[model samples]
Target: MIIGIDLGTTNSLVSVWRDGQVELIPNALGDMLTPSVVGLDADGAVLVGLAARERLITHPQLTAAVFKRYMGSDRKTLLGSQAFRPEELSALVLKSLKADAERYLGEPVEEAVITVPAYFSDAQRKATKIAGQLAGLKVERLVNEPTAAALAYGLHQSEPESRFLVFDLGGGTFDISILELFEGVMEVRASAGDNFLGGEDFSEALIDGFIAAVGKQHGLTDKTADPAVYQNLRKQAEQAKRALTGAPTATMTVLHAGEPLSWTLSDGDFLKLCEPLLKRLREPIEKALRDSRLKAIDLDQVVLAGGATRKPLVRKLVAKLFGRMPAMNLNPDEVVARGAAVMAGLKARDVALSEVVMTDVCPYSLGIEVSEQLGPGRFQPGFYLPIIERNSVVPISREQIVSTIVDNQPALHVSIFQGESRLVKDNIFLGELILPVPPRPAGQISVAVRFTYDVNGLLEAEMTVAETGEKHRLLIEDNPGVLSPEQIEERLAALAKLKIHPRELLPNATLLARADRLYQQLLGEQRQWLAQETARFQAVLESQDEALILPARTELKQFLDEIEGDGWL
Candidate 1:
């Protein structure tokens, strides 16, 4: 069966369409939301989700989080002695989600429709598909995150024809999409975003503010950087961010040289610290509206999505810009996954959704590099010729023809790129191809370069030499960021060998790891109380009696909830 996945920067979730409704699958911890974290145990066993997220604080060196930001790059993060690519880390999370879907559905799941940020480049989208492959899943489609959000909101509303804007600000990326729904058709008018801006930047701003205020007084300079301390502060910053969503104040504390340093942050202080990030949100919103050829006042509804939009500051900024209070009827965090489930249903040809049609737009321009001839023997290189412009409808094919710049050019060099820059140097190089042509005079041999972009965000370029009718294709499969078949096989075997923490033991393991993490952060009485309760829970697990273990686990969870402020960890 095909399932839907939201492989987010901070969290991931699995859902499926069943019994005429979208059903979210719970992880081993029995929670719909799973932290996108991975780590290794003392015995070298693999740990995922909540347990690994907790371990991030206690064992900072052995855990990895926020790797999604490096999805299309060749960056590697190390856990203990092992170094892993971003795709590898993401695969572990996907594998865990696949297992959860299997358990919930009582069947093996082999295919999925995964959602990604609308602004993700072609390389990043390819990496996401590769991650699904590494997890033994056939990625049927890669749905844009904002498009998915719009789809969910579109179906949820009763209006037959309406225009809406989806403002999606997640943990590590931001996207804005303008859409229109009419006669069972949901059409994306435009998409714009900043892949680098998100809620994480806000947390980082708070961290920087704290360091500037008093960190130097404690001899904590750039030379004295500590991973554990950074992780602790990041956690506190995230909590403070969430607390300030509704409350006017929150406390952020961290340890330095075995001493606790504290700061009480107010809403005004946070706004001042994060003013730059708030300003960044405006550019994309205005761009999306402009590209759609519609003004903010023309929109029927403004929808708020992604977990970051829950912040009061972000909501206020959106409302003031759009002149309307954004729609929040659906859960922001789960809306994308719900839309993905709907897409999966559409793929399955569900009768209830047979009439529902959806469309998406390419968020960036795809083109090829060319040289302009200023005069004879005075040609200038590095000019970019766009084949498909940004915001163009997907599942489209566009072509452009060019001739060799120099006489007797044995082969035509094709360098495919993606961007809106006027110079090839400023654009992103996707891949290249070389097609042989007979030796001929300049501007005599013409080659047609065709770029076909599908709904899955895959780009295929085919170049045909007019003189000899020779054709060459570039599928971007040979990119350095993508792994080869041999490498995938090797990595698959290695992942199979690692002992994943058993599903049956995840509850106890997660609880113990959380308690251990909290223990490291607390002091005096609170630490002692946590230790006593953790010991009790451990004893119950060791007893192996279902009757006592169930109740004991529940009680310990309640205790932790009261102390830790409801899953903020």
Candidate 2:
């Protein structure tokens, strides 16, 4: 069966349209949300979800998180002795989710509707699709995050005729979309966002404050940076952020270079620290409104989405700007996965959700690079001529005419890019093709460049000569990651060979990793007690006494839980 998945930056979730409603599938942890972290165990087995996430704090240099921010780039995350691309890590997450879905549904899941940020480039979207493929799932649609959230909000649940805005600030990406709904039609009028911004930035703000405190107390120098300290700070900062979501204040503490640093940040103080990042949010909001040709007052409703929206300051910013409180009934974290499930239902033509029609637009301009000839033989090759401007309806095609610059020009290099800049250098280069042309005067031999962008954000460019009917096309096809198909297959093989611990051992492994990690942070009596308890548990485990293992495991867990303290947050 086909399911819907939210391969999010911070956490990933899977859901399905069950009994005419969306049902979120929980993982082995019995949690609907799975942390988007990947790492290696002591045995070199791949660890995902909660186990991997806890590993991140204990083994900072050996784990990867927030890799979503580099989806389309050639950047790699080094973990263990191996290096992994963002898409590769994403595939591992997808594989884990697929396994969970299969176990929960009691059947094989071969297809899904995956969601991406509205502002994600073609390369990023392609990488998402490829990741799904690597997980052995057919990804037929790449839904925009904001659009998916709107669906989950069940906009059709409201008045048929309305204009609304979606503010989606997730872990690693931000997106603002303006949409209109009329008669059973939901149309996305404009979409904009900053991929580099999100909840992680807020955590970073807290991190900076705590780091500064530690720096002053310890005089810590770089090049001798402590991974454990950074990792612990990241966890503490994340917890402090959640605590301050609605509370007036929250406390964050960490140890660096034997110095214990702490900060009790008030909401006002936290907001002040995050001023710059919060300010960046307005640009996309204003841009989306401008692109939609609507005012904040024109919106019938303002919607808040993504885990970051849980932040009180973020909500306050929205109210201050729109002059109206945004919708908050739907759980921000679960909304996108639910909406994706609804889309899957729609794709399946489920009778319950068949009435509403959805439409989306391209998020960026599409065009080709051409040289504009200046008089006296000087020409500039970096000129960008757009064939399709951003926000144009999808499954749409547009053509731009180009003339040969010189007499008898042998070929026309059809270089395609996606961006809003007038200079080609500033745009993202998608691909290019060189097509031969007959010898003729520069202006006499012209060809039409056709750009087609589909609903899924798939793009194809073709160059055609009217007279000879000769054509050349550039198709990145569905592969947009830094790796080609051959490379992808090779990587897939490598991933398939990696060992992953049995599901039953995950809980034990995670707890052991956590305890072992804490061992590195403790001292004196606490350290000695933990060491003795860990050794006892290890002896029990190694003894292979099935009768005693269960109780010993519980005993060990209780011991750790008793000492977890406030730092457990």
Candidate 3:
């Protein structure tokens, strides 16, 4: 069986198309949402979802979160005793979701359709597919998150024709996609975003505000040396942020190094604090609108997706910018998963989705970087000439002509990149290829570099030598990582050796980790108190009092959360 997976930044979910409708598959906790976190327990077993997230607060040095932001990069996250690439961490999450889907369906799932941000680069998208492969699933399609949301929304709505803008601001990334829906067709016109901007950044803005205020009042330095203290304050501020979503006022309180610091922020004040982030959101929206050749009034609907869009300020900003309220009838968080399921159904050629056809655009420009001569011997090395522009419909082929730079040049180097910068140094280098050219004078031997992009986001670069009808095609592998295929295999073997606890023990393990973390964060009396609670919980867990364990775990966790003044989940 094949399932649709919304492997998100903050939380991930899986769904399946059954009975002509989409249904979400719940995890072991019986919740559809799984926290995108991974870590190791004291026993050296892998822990994921809530359990891992809880450890992130307690054992900040031993857990990893928000690795999704590093997708396609050479960056690695260090856990307690191992280092993992972002794709590997993502694979763990995908494995957890796959387990849930299998258990729910009572069947094996070998394939899936995953969703990514519309503006995700080719490298990032390919990294996602690799992550799926690591999780033991074949990933054939990657739908844009915003486009998936539109599918979920438009498929159910009564409207026969509509042009909408999808504003998706999730935990760690933002994407704005403009799409048109007409006669059972959903065509994505354009996409744009800043990968670093999202709800977590907003939370950081609040944390920064608190830290600045505390530093000024205490006459201390601007930065804290302790990461634990920073993470603790960040957690509290995040909870307070959620509280402030609908409420007018909220306070963030944390006890740090024997000092109790508290700050109350009003909606107006919070907005002021997030002025920079709010300003950043406008760029992608404007870019999407401009690329779609759309005016504010031309949009038939403004569909808001992602959990971050639930904020009142976000809604107000959209309303003010578009002169209309964005649709709120559907749950923003679940919209992408639902739409992904619809896509999965379409991929499977299910009769219900036979009429639905979708198309997507390239989110960035693709071109070759070459040296350009100014007048005489003066040459610039980073000139970029685009063969395919950004926001152009994909499954497309575009070509641009380039000539030999010197007389009787036998070989020419073709360096392909993806970006809008006029300087090639500023763009993302995809790969380099060498083409053999027949000896000819400068600007005489014309070579046409053809770039063909398919729905999978993979690129095929081909160079046709006009003089001899000689052609060379190279498939650029999207792995910009440090590992080769052999090294990845070795890494995979090593990773597979790690142990993972049974799913049923996740909640107990999570509470224990939380209590242990609290013990570490507090000092003196508070530490002793947390240690005692930890012992009590440990006793209850050892006793195997199945009925009593949950209540005790909940009570202990609630007590610690109450003491810390954090209600964030």
Highest TM-score among the candidates is held by which one? 1
Root mean square deviation (Cα) for candidate 1: 1.4
Pairs of colliding residues, candidate 2: none
Model 3 over residues 329-364: C-alpha lDDT tens digits? Answer: 788889999999998999998998888999998889
Candidate 2, 1-569: lDDT as tens digits:
77999999999999998788899999887789888999998788889988888887688777889999998877888997899999999998999999999999999999999999999988898888888988889996999999999887754365768888999999999999888888888899999999999999998888787656555556644412777777787788888887887689888766666656678879888888999999999999888888899999999889888999989899999999999899887888988999899999998888888778999999899898988878677787999999999999788999998888887899888888889999999988888788898989777988999988998998988889976998887775533446788887998899889887777677677778878877876778998999999889889889778688879888888888888652332
Candidate 3's clash total is: 1
My TM-score estimates for the predictions, one after another, are 0.98, 0.95, 0.94
Candidate 1: residue pairs that collide: none
lDDT of 2: 0.85
Total colliding residue pairs, candidate 2: 0
Instruction: Tell me the tens digit of each residue's lDDT in model 1 across 267-378.
Output: 9999999899999999998888878999998999998878999899999998899888999999999999999999999888898888899999999899998989898688
Better of 1 and 2 by lDDT: 1
Each model's lDDT comes to 0.90, 0.85, 0.85
Candidate 3 accuracy as TM-score: 0.94
